[model samples]
Target: MSQQTKSDYVDDVDVDDDWDDHPTDDELEATVENLEASGFDVEVVSDAEEALDVLVSEIPAGASVMNGHSTTLEEIGFDDYLGEGDHDWENLAADIWSIDDDAERDAARRAAQTADYFLGSVNGIAQDGTLVAADLSGSRVGAYPFAAQNLLLVAGVNKVVEDVEAARERLHEFAYAFENERAQEAYGVESYPSKELVYRQEGTEGRTTVVLVEETLGY
Candidate 1:
């Protein structure tokens, strides 16, 4: 058998060709209105790099920050910046993983959920302003409900679907497969969406912020 190489799994691998679909202007306007009406603050960014710049300004200095596993986050350079950038915020994920002991690492992960800022990406966004996401484990989505002090979700405009049913299909058609590819490459195992989270509404006035990028990015 040929030896498996990073290039074989990641470089030349085929990704789904569904980005040809672009939402109309009416669709974008309505989706943004619906998202805001649903009580979540929404900001539309022009491109991935611009999204990164805006995100940095949005996060407060010296805040404790924790982020979930998200391709979008990596796409926008958050993963690299947060890990290596000389910033005032505490890198909770780095701190958690640095613990050599497995039990202590797990405990740190749980505690990090309550960080001042919890950043992540969502799989789907319904035109009605609903946010949909899933996780292989509860560690990621677990803090969105009420634990984290603040939440930041960055997604591409392509993730905006017609409705909740379409959102589910979006997950099955794109998010799951893309994530599985990443998991297989990184861990040598497949991944499934075991836990689901539908953010229907945000009761707090400014607790949740949604950054929507115009360019096609992530799954």
Candidate 2:
């Protein structure tokens, strides 16, 4: 299947555009500080290229890597990079997709949660340092809380919100609409927030990193 960009679904979805605006410098800095205080290693990048570079530099060679569906990663060119880039890491996503049998492929997906590095994007980020994301199935969030040995979350500043409640509102009212439309277009199936995760703090040290790009990206 071909990769779809945000432009492919943006016109079909109705959402409050304000939720997709880049945060002010003060808001960004405060959010970074709070995220750090909450035990999440936060990296602020000026643009998508810088974010991609940081993402690439985080993982070591030969490690098994898997990622959930993330338009932000595609926007930054990481999806194509991981799929075709010259890297020694074991691309579990590619491996899982190559499976022919339905049951085997499903099992591979479940087993991939333990991949050395699991990468994905967050739907909403609260300035208070909570990360909110939802998935029609538990595929994406299943690795975020603790399943994966390490997690890499890449998101644009547009995802930042006032608090956990605001984050959830953004997810339910804004991100969900865009995602549902995208799902219908891509998979010919409707999507919903059937599973949601509210991540407040990380107990494991150096196990998770949040890359915040200054540009507006993803839902």
- Among these predictions, the greatest TM-score belongs to 2
RMSD of 2: 0.9
TM-score of 1: 0.91
Candidate 2 displacement at residue 1 in angstroms? 2.9
Q: Considering summed lDDT, which 10 consecutive residues are worst modelled in model 2?
A: 1-10
Candidate 1: what lDDT?
0.83
Number of the top candidate by lDDT? 2
Q: In angstroms, how far off is 24's CA in candidate 2? A: 1.7
Tens-digit lDDT string for candidate 1 (147-168) = 8999999988988888888777
Query: Model 1 residue 83 lDDT?
Result: 82
For residue 207, what is the lDDT in candidate 1?
95
Candidate 2 TM-score, true structure as reference: 0.98
Query: Stretches of candidate 2 above 4 Å error?
Result: none
lDDT (10s digit) by residue, model 2, range 1-219: 687777787788877888887777898899999999989999999899999999899999989999999989989999899988579899999999899999999999999999999999998999989999999989999999999999999999999988999999999998898888888878899999989999999999999999999898898
User: lDDT of all the models against the reference?
Assistant: 0.83, 0.92
Kindly state the number of residue pairs that clash in model 1: 0
